[model samples]
Target: MSLNSNLARKVEVEIPLQSPSNVPEQSTGMVHRSISKKSLATRVEKMLMGIIMAIAFTLIAVSISLEINIASTNRALQDTKVSILNTTTINSNLQQEVQELSRYDRIYRFANKQGLKMNEANVRNVVK
Candidate 1:
């Protein structure tokens, strides 16, 4: 019925603040940081992928180096084989020449054709 009473009835009420001791205390050393499971999983997956890629790159480099070494060794072996074959051919030809010169008649004819005189004392017999 009075204006003051009507105004008080229409006003909204508010609660008073309680003492800080009524609320639970937060620990000093505790951290409240949070990461989503999806973000954590993505981070772990990215780390694993990076590790796998590094290992793969290292293996590929080693394999390429090994391949190069093998190719070089193979080339060296081929060159050695070629040198051996050439030496064998030269040895065979030298042996044939020595055999041809070992005949007494061939030696005498060759000395005569070259206008060289053979002395008896200059001839030596090789006993094998």
Candidate 2:
């Protein structure tokens, strides 16, 4: 009955309990909690996943580029083949015409037309 009213009305402060985990968590928003600790294994796993995806994407792009180059090369080769065939046909035709124009009868006829006479004594057999 002798105690002061101020002592009885003094406010007491209570501390909140700490979390069990070694790292602390932060409340970011009303619905989300942010982690303060990032494990090494988790970071490494994410890095490895990103590297693998980048490599895969690069390989796919390279493969697609190679396919396009191959198609272009194939088309160029086909065009060259056609040109070669055409040129070869023209060469063969020219050779055939030369053969036709070089016959003994044709030569003799042209020679006679130019007022040239063949002398049997001066004729020599040629060997190839």
Candidate 3:
């Protein structure tokens, strides 16, 4: 049994051993692949999408600007209407004053207070 064991040890020791550093290396060259290009229809579609986005943005901006302008115009119109109403009231008061001042009795009393003598022959009645 001892002799058989010694023969087994000798056989194990005689076998060859391989290390990682002693192994052969494979090729490290770059591989080539075919380059693909987009089709004309796909390019055109992308361009049209960009144009549509730009047009949409422009329309939104224009509508907002017009809305602001409309609001401003409405404010101005409201102010004008208020001014016209105030002027109309002032004009009505002035017309009432004119009518009072132009009354025949009022004028006659004023003339009497000023020591004016009435001349029936020279007096003339004016018609509007």
Candidate 4:
């Protein structure tokens, strides 16, 4: 009792606890985690792109092959035309030779060489 009377009275301090806020605040930009769900969609998109590119390449290759085939076919057609022209020329020459050989003098000589006697009834007498 004597020591308490001699010392000064001690003072007690109280700190108030912080309370939770009731109003919600909006954020400017928020980042969310969703790796597992987005990964499958990304893989599917990449696979589809690959398939499209492969189809495009195949189409290009087919077109190039078709162009080459067309060129070869055109060359063959030109060769055929040249051969036909040569044949036509030969045919015309043969026709000219046949016409020359069908003359009356040539026919008479050919008949005499063949020992074929010309009948008066068969031979039309032409006063040339």
Candidate order by decreasing TM-score: 2, 3, 4, 1
Candidate 4 structure, TM-score to reference: 0.61
> What count of clashes does model 3 give?
0
lDDT of each: 0.88, 0.87, 0.85, 0.87
**Which window of ten consecutive residues has the lowest lDDT sum in model 2?**
30-39
What are the per-residue Cα lDDT tens digits for candidate 3 across 38-69? 45567788899999999999999999999999
Q: Model 4 over residues 1-128: C-alpha lDDT tens digits?
A: 57658678778989877665754664534322355457768989999999999999999999999999999999999999999999999999999999998998999999899999888888676697
Ranking 2 against 3 by lDDT, winner: 2
TM-score for every candidate vs. truth?
Answer: 0.58, 0.65, 0.64, 0.61
Best by lDDT: 1
lDDT of 1 at 123: 78
Could you give candidate 1's per-residue lDDT for residues 6-110 as a string of tens digits?
454655789899999999997644433334556778899999999999999999999999999999999999999999999999999999999988998987898
Higher-ranked by lDDT: 1 or 3 = 1
Top candidate when judged by TM-score against the true structure: 2
Give the range where candidate 4 is weakest over 10 consecutive residues by summed lDDT. Answer: 27-36
lDDT by residue (3-85, candidate 2, tens digit) is 65455565689998877785676556623322323455678889999999999999999999999999999999999999999
Which residue pairs show collisions in model 1? none
Task: Say which prediction, candidate 2 or candidate 3, comes out ahead on TM-score.
Answer: 2
Q: Model 3: which ten-residue window has the lowest total lDDT?
A: 29-38
